[model samples]
Target: MNKNIITLEYRISKLLRYGVMLAGALMFVGWMSMLDFTQNPLLAFHDYREVTFVHSIGYAWRDKVWGLLTAYAGLILLISLPLSRVLMTAILFWRQKERLLSGIAFFVFAALIISFSLGIEL
Candidate 1:
């Protein structure tokens, strides 16, 4: 095979892999948010009364914490999401390097999933 052909093959393979990763990340987020967190407002009371994490935060700090979480969650998704795709494209040029992009994508994906599942809309 020619040198140019091999390079093209590697670039294509890298792009395909990156696309798969990004799709997986998005699907994972969507799956997590499929719950009925918003279907009942009473669930908030339950969370406050029952969930240990919610109880630990306490009602006083709930709004503030929720605000921060919402802001960051939206920001992360808006930023990391497009960045993930762009970085994957960049990976082609960078030669299949998935370290940094994968980590950022994972974090952003998790944040998006949690925020969506908890009915935190922005």
Candidate 2:
């Protein structure tokens, strides 16, 4: 019975981890689409300029798209972050066999929770 409980918890934790990663990916993609990185660095800018072929393409789409990408990106990140933590906690509870993974997941989830809660966007 005790083993079964642990297994159940472990499975929940795994699901949570997967959820957080998915949320993070979605948020990252959304957050990235917001900026005209071709023109300005929203986050980091040094004397060095950041340029990408992708930004060039995005530039063309920018006027036509009418900020849809930025809107969607913001929405997804805002929604996914909290959801990610919930999922992470669930996964942590579910995965017991893999101690290393569980530990890593816990730390990652914890950090994500703190960072996201603080609204520290990359």
Candidate 3:
């Protein structure tokens, strides 16, 4: 394998691993806090209801709800991991001068961004 490809793969693996770890940690804290307050996470779920993560984040910020904010931030990061991977792959393909692959990656990235922005479930 090419050195560049190996390096890219290593970087991507690290990104995924760390991203998941961080998200899990954030969720753990969030759930712990919820449990502390309501004595049950599920029972308190409705207290932080929102139409979307974006809205939840805004509400959390305004209300200074640390638990809700951490949870939503983690969710947003988790949800965006695939998009980040696609973007990184696109950049790699571009650097490697693989125009077709790069273009396809870019197209997929754009599609994901559009669907995510429009709140389209797939």
Query: Best by lDDT, which number?
Result: 3
Clashing pairs in 1: none
Instruction: Report RMSD for candidate 3.
Output: 3.1
lDDT of 3 at 93: 92
- Encode model 1's per-residue lDDT on 6-88: one tens digit a residue: 77768767766765566566555544543456677356557544444345346426555454344334444544545455444
| CA lDDT of each prediction against the hidden true structure | 0.53, 0.60, 0.83
lDDT-wise, the better of 1 and 2 is 2
For TM-score, the strongest prediction is 3
Using TM-score as the measure, name the better of candidate 2 and candidate 3: 3
In terms of lDDT, model 3 sits at 0.83
lDDT of 3 by residue, 55-114 (tens): 766777898889877776787789888899999999999998999999999999999989
Tell me how candidate 1 scores on lDDT: 0.53
- How high is each candidate's TM-score? 0.31, 0.36, 0.82
lDDT for model 2, please. Answer: 0.60
Q: Candidate 1: give its CA RMSD in angstroms.
A: 12.1
* Candidate 2 lDDT by residue in tens digits, 21-107: 766666566556655757755444446655453574476476665344544454565566555655555565555465667667777
